[model samples]
Target chain A: MTEEPFRWLEAIANRRDYVQQQIGTGSPVFAVSLEAGILLLGVGSGQSKVFEIFDRQAMAALGHPADIERVRQMLIDAAHLEAFTRASADVNVRRLVSFGLSPQLKQSFEQIFQAPFMIDLLLGEVAEHPSKDVLVKVNFDGGFKIQHGGVMVAAPKPEQVTLATDWLKANLDQKLKPESAALVLLLAWNSLTSGTPLPEKSEQPVKLPDALVEQLSDKVVEAAVLERKGSNVARYVPLMPLLTG
Target chain B: MNTGIAGDFLGLLAQNNLRPLAAESSTRAPEQTHATTVFAFRFRDGVLVAGDRRATAGNVIVADDVNKIIEIDRHSLLAIAGVPAMAFEMARVMQVSFAYYRRSQLQPLSQEAKVRALARLLRENLPLTLQGVGVVAPVFATVEAQGDKVVPRIYFYDPLGAQFEAVAFAASGSGSGTVRSVLSFQERFGEVKPSTMTLNQAIRFAHNVLTVASEFDAATGGVDPLRTVWPVIKVLDANGVRDVEAAEHLDARKEGV
Candidate 1:
């Protein structure tokens, strides 16, 4: 049997695909899990939804019964990713990188999943280090590529080389805040699924206020609420925008 | 020391048919010379790993100068807070294992790999931990180079061998409760952000926390300025790991800077 981590990722992807097929259109979901915090955004069938990612039961359905407890613990850990983020709020991104799955565990996961588990880390500027932000992408094949002042895509080879690359380059170049990053990713996904021309530039840049962004959708609002509740202190504000209208 | 072994150090140990001392002991005895109070947190430059120099046997203090913080490698630090002997042995095995990996693979083990290796070792010693002969909660950390930037990471482990990657800070041992309370209070109300603390501030904060722990917990030791015996304080970052000297520690306390 495959390892729990591998099984869990596969199960989530499979379930996501099933959801998209059932809705009869592309549901491009983008998720970022940091420490125990999770942010998931989905655009499906002309509607955008923001919600939490996988649950233990959903994962259990795809794997062995005995592995349920272990998988549950792993998911619980993932849920606490935000707490970790909050705790390390003063830390530079370089030190934060060490607080993830070990290389040995990653190897085990890769062996079981038959693909590399990619890590795309976005690091902010540190005073002692260089002034530039960095995006480090570790491929599934155990190799990694570093990008300074560029974009990264994790889709299939064709999409990554074609549509995704074009959209990111044309639309995104400047340093992006969390909300802007989420917006750009969602917009890119919409363009990819709809085969619409990538916007070369915006006449009036999209402006999303923290309060209005919080009221985007129930799913997005819930995500924000959950994050605030989990930390027991309001440290993180999940970017939620009403894109459906 | 065994030679002519292949693969990592752990693999080499298995090849030599060697089992941990805990695995050999069938009769469980409640031996409790446990070390206490160790933690690590990220600072401006890298991560600061600190531990009080105290070990206790039941109700009696056995050693006051026990160095609980062990440097596992150039980039990695391990702070153990349980059975002193077991913790020391675990640190030794980790050092050897890491060296073996580097020697064999011609490259140092990544921070993640070091964390996992230690976790597995602790997991294998769980039986002893359960028997109260080898209970150890450890914080392992390292600094890595990503692009031109250096990142410091910290991980906390349980007696069951479960590894947790602490995002900003982690604490373990007998006085861990007190230490954590102090940390939480600082995070909630402290003027400086815990993650953004400078090296001097982090060292001072750690000292203050350990001093608080020493007040209530007999096993936890406080700073001894007169004796020049302070907590084992070390910092790991882009420059490398280095122990905070006694003189500097004394100066920090005197100046309150």
Candidate 2:
């Protein structure tokens, strides 16, 4: 009976490996903060990976479609509830992540008797200035990190996440328009999925990777932006036309 | 009780047992804050919605800076003319609910569905309304797209949640009796119908109507040039809702015919 705890730990580790294997080939989601607002981009075959969570917030995920939907619904409910109980302006990513989502995810993950969530989520919140933008990356195991306005990635392959994010950070311009930012994210996605290395140096004028652009024809790009300057209080706007056009 | 889904914010609030105010505290009659004088009319461009800047509590002027006209979404305006607390709560809930539905469902809630949603909220609030502590008669205005043509619609709701489509105009609150009569008179005999007037003339007519109402009903604070407070007017067209500027209010106040 004394070895029960050790055995349980081993089981937990096995579950981690199982989840990682299940999500290894899932599509990647990327986000970058720009002068207009924050843009979240994801490419997938059928289901949508990008969604608006609140007035100034949006989310993108890569994993099992059902699990991603569950998390997305949970986020939407939490945001609305927060906006209801308090005010809409007070509904932000930090509170939603730190107080609401992270704990729920951790509890679900620790409860080994049930299946852990098989998803990696990227949530972005726009602010008046690009430097003050907020981006949160929530992992399958409930681990998360908050970053100030820059670039972030939730790559399907765990090993390439840092490489992809670093490449984006070095290559992404803070002033890129919505369409251009989407193109940059798509190039990074192509690089990560095709196992090709991004250029070592930044290109003066960003260009679509000719070799990798064709693969995107079969995939639908899901994108949304939270515009900073708008008369309406609801700032989250979908950018499907920006790419599809 | 958790559905593990989104799109119904009010339902979620009920599940959480969250109310704008405690329901059990109705043991004694509390002094209710009442907002007065809100109306809407179809104009040449779209719909012109306006609300007075006064709230009263049993013959006592409680506040003069209250904003009773609320923007539920970009395309809809809600003007309330009853208990300020309950009316504002309803507006807040509708705003969030509309947004929640759009974000979760990935499509705008239909115009019919949006109007019905307000009716549902009033129906739910019947308990408080019967207690005489919460009563809200509100006017809703929106621009609905029909095929390629966008048309403006106005709806007014009773405290018991009965919704009626306002063809030319609708008014609510203590001063509405006078405002309604004047509107009917203008629509029937004036040089231009309220629905056919230009934007500038519409603004002038709104100011004139509110001014006439305040002259008879103390609850409606008309054009208080000394306090520099004018009625809040918003225009809802195919594009969206935009506030009439304070300068425009000055122009309307100065050029009233």
Best by lDDT: 2
Write down the C-alpha DockQ for each prediction: 0.01, 0.59
Which regions of candidate 1 are displaced past 4 Å? A1-245, B1-6, B25-30
Best DockQ goes to which candidate? 2
True contacts kept of 2: 0.67
**Candidate 1 residue lDDT tens string, B1-257:** 22344335554455446554446555647557989999898888899999998888888888889888888777888999988777887887786566545533435787777888888888888778776677888998898899999989989988898988888889999899998888878877889967789877888888898989989888888776677688999999897778898876876787573
Calculate candidate 1's fnat: 0.00
Provide the overall lDDT of each model, using Cα atoms, as 2-decimal numbers: 0.58, 0.86
lDDT of 2 by residue, B1-257 (tens): 23634467666777898865346547587788899999999889999999889999988999898888899999999999999888888898899889888877888999998999889888878888888888889999988999988899999999999999999999999999999999999999988999899888899899889989999999998867677677899999989899998888777667657
- Provide the lDDT at A66 for model 2: 92
